[model samples]
Structure formats: structure tokens, C-alpha cells
Target: MHKRVHYAFTVKRNQKNLHHQLATLPRAKASVKFSDRTDTHGRLETRVVQAPAVSDLGVDFPHATQVAKIIRHRTQRKNGKRSRETVYAITDLTSRQASPEHIAKIARSQWTIQNRLHFVRPTAFAEDASKVRTGHGPDNMAALRSFAVNQLRATGRTNIAAGLRAMSYEPFRRPLDLLCLT
Candidate 1:
């Protein structure tokens, strides 16, 4: 039997057509909504997520089951500074498979995924400074960087930068051993 995978993604301004489709949705009377608040490091943040089933909303994406708008309001407790932003997204999961609240959680968790994996590439590996700019060079370099990070993680290291530093101190052949090329 074949397995099916589901995913949710934010619609960026670059996706002009899809973004416009989701943008034109009625701002009033959403079919479902969820909100939550959290206090962290002198910041009080509240997030409201509104979603509607899109079977007839005419989203141009393939297999799009729902569309949502997430609004976040953040205020620094000490300074009383406030900021707000809104984001739009779509998901393949039907409303029956995932609630508006569940979709909100999935959307927020994407940041954690980015921070743990891709974010480290530039910070810890200096991927941004790489000179490989032609064709497959950049792609292959990215894959190698990801593999290095994953290898370090598989060795039970939580701090990737520190893991890299520790590995650098090892003999040159030690890192090669991790690649199983022997």
C-alpha cells in the first residue's frame, strides 16, 4: 500500500496568484477560529488564527483543503512596545483531519523546524559565506551541510556549533569515519 503525506505551507507574496486568491477571501465571519496567549522573556504575545474550509473558495493550489490567516500581536511588558503581523497559509489536511487550532499549532511549529535545521546552516557552518555559486555546487554543498548537522545530531549533540568545534579538534580522519567511507 502507498502512503500519503500531508503538509501545510505559508503563502508568500512571491506566489502572486495563490496569494491573491487567499487574500480576496472575506475578512468577516470566518468558519472557524482559535486564539491563545503566552508570556515569555518580558513579552506578552497573543495569536489569533482564523480558518475556513476552501472547497469552494477557489484556491488554485492542488489538493488545498483549507486556508487560514494567522494574526499575532506582541507587546514587550517592560517597555510597552507593541507589534503585529498577519500571515496566510494553506494545508492539505481536511477540517475533519485537523482542526483550526491544530492547524495553528502546525503552522507555528514550522519555525522551530527551520531554526533547528536550516537556520544552523548559515550560523554554524557559515553556509552563506560559501564560494560555491555555480549550478550543482551550491546544492551539493547544502546537502553536505545538512548531512554534517544530522551526523552531529545523531551523535547526541544538541549544540551544533559546539559540536562542530569539537569535531574540528579531532584528527582529520575522525570526521571522515563518521561518513562511513572506509
Candidate 2:
């Protein structure tokens, strides 16, 4: 059942790889193209997307219908630093099921998950810096951190850092009260 589900995945850039070949193709050869620019989180970013038909590539990706390339140019507002990145992806959806604009939206929306969940787990909860390497210790710690984050979000605490600080005063007692666990 999982194999039949439609999905998209980013392709790695490797020499002689199908994804790399697609990425190197000229923009004029693309079947669909889209570009946009935005200022997000104090950084200016321009994303140019190119999508080509999967059938033309002679590659065998199960249920694959389209290949896409995203070129991103980013500039930091404070440090004046600049960077460029090109990403490639393949999706099971055909051109009809997923248009270039729609695919771009899907690709860009992935960052929201990264920012809200992945980033907060590491930075706000200090999960990455933790040295709990014993059997089940890391997993248990991660679960506890996730529970805390969920509790904070559930209680309408928008600022996780502040919520953590507030809970740390009484440690065990405070969290139990916050969650009504007592």
C-alpha cells in the first residue's frame, strides 16, 4: 500500500546521475518553469524552478512522472553573506496532477516543518547537544522533549524558550502543574 502512495523526494547531485543530468539541462529545455523572490527571516531569497517530463530522461523511477530543479539564491540582510544552491526532485504526480506552480509551493512549504519542528527540537530543546547515549536514554529524552514542546504549544505559549524558562523554576513540580499531570 505504501508503495502506491504518491510522493516526491529530493535527489542528490552526483556526477553521471540521472538527477544531476536533469539539473544541468538548459532552462529553455524545461517543459515548465517558475520563479519567485521573497524576504524571509531577514534573508532575501530567489527561487527558480524548472520541471521537465520524466519520460524524456530514460530513467526508471517507479511511478515517476516529472523531474524538477530548484535554484535558490539567498542573501543575508545583516552579514551581507550570499549563497546559491540547486536542488533536484522527482515526483510521482504527472504534469496534470501537479503543475509547476503547485510543485513549487509544495517544495517551499517543507521548510515550515523544518523551522517549526526540526529546528525547535534542536535549538529550543537542546536535543542535539545532549550526551545521553546509553540504551534508550536518548530516545526517552527525545520523547520527553517532544512532550514538553507539545505541552507548551497546547497551552498557547508561543515562545518556547520563555515557556521552558518558566517551567524550569520548579522543575518537576512546575511541568506537572502545567500539564495537569498531578
Candidate 3:
């Protein structure tokens, strides 16, 4: 079974640039809620209201605390989304050998999956508008779409939607070779 544990932290407002940064950490599944607040200048301030338990740090709180420290420093000082300094906590549910770097990797990976896999595919491909909202249909079609995306990405087509569209438009061999189930 997968070892899982929880921790908590805060993400500051005004750091839109760091959304991807937090999502790429190790052992992070999902956040419960993210919200917006009002800043002193009356601009919109966004924060990570809740996140999943991060499990890739060591078994004890010390290691988890170290991860939090690194998150705080990195998010605050990073090149994007300049803000007054907001902090967010994560709880990593991971194995015994998980290191801080590993913890970070899990966090990053979670974000990548959410943004690159889920959000981008739907928005770019208009997957949500297919009207296949019933049992198994949407999911099945999504799986096929994901398969196509993986094939295109494997062939060096990085933009997922574009790749899908290209495959849709092309003639016999290349696109068929891409989507073929051999």
C-alpha cells in the first residue's frame, strides 16, 4: 500500500506565477480549495486555501518542516509572481526513504498532472463540451484522447491540442501510425 500522511501550509496572495511551482512537488495529490482575497491596492489576491497531504518527506516532522522551509524560501524568492510573501503548507504521504528533494519532485509532478494533463487537455481540445457526460463514455473517450496525446508527445509534438488537431487533419500514414494500437 502507498504510505500517506498530511501536513498544512499557507500560500500567499498575488503569486499567480507560482501556481505551477507548487503543483510539481512530490507526493501531492490535490488541494482542497484555493481562494482569492482583496489586497491593499484593491487588486485580487489569490491563495492556496488547502492542499493534499505531501508524503515524500521523511517520516518525522523535522523532515516535513524542512520541506516547508524550502517551499517558503523558494516561493518567496522565485522569479515569478512577485508578492508580499505568502506561505503554503503541504503534507506528504510517502515512503520511508523519501528525501526532501524527492518530496519536491512529487509536488511538482502533481501540478504537472493537474495543469498539463487535465486542465490543458480539456481547454485545448474542448473535451468538456463533447456532451458525453454519462457513465463511462466521458471517461473512455478521455482515455483515448490521452492516448493520442501521449503518442504525439512521444513523437516530439509538445503542444497537446495542436498535435491532436494535426493528427485529425493529416492523411494516411503518420497520424494513423501515431494513433494505431499495435
- Give the top-scoring candidate (lDDT): 1
- Give the C-alpha miss distance for residue 171 in model 3, angstroms: 5.5
Candidates in order, TM-scores: namely 0.90, 0.74, 0.47
lDDT string, candidate 1, 1-182, tens digits = 99999989987678788777788887674768999998987999898988888877777889998888888899999989999977787999988888879988998898887999999999998888999999999999999899999998898889999988887887576687666655
TM-score (C-alpha, index-matched) for candidate 3? 0.47
What lDDT does each candidate get? Answer: 0.86, 0.81, 0.52
Kindly list the per-residue Cα lDDT of model 2 for residues 1-182, writing each as its tens digit.
Answer: 36657787767565447665666555565767889999989999998888877776665667777888888899999999999988877798888888777778888878877776668889897887899999999989888887888899899998889999999999979988998989
Better of 1 and 3 by TM-score: 1
Error of 1 at 116 (Å): 0.5
lDDT of 3 by residue, 93-153 (tens): 3333444444445444565677767886688778868988889998899998777667777
Clashes of 3: 27
* CA RMSD of each candidate after superposition: 1.9, 3.8, 11.4
TM-score order of candidates, best first? 1, 2, 3
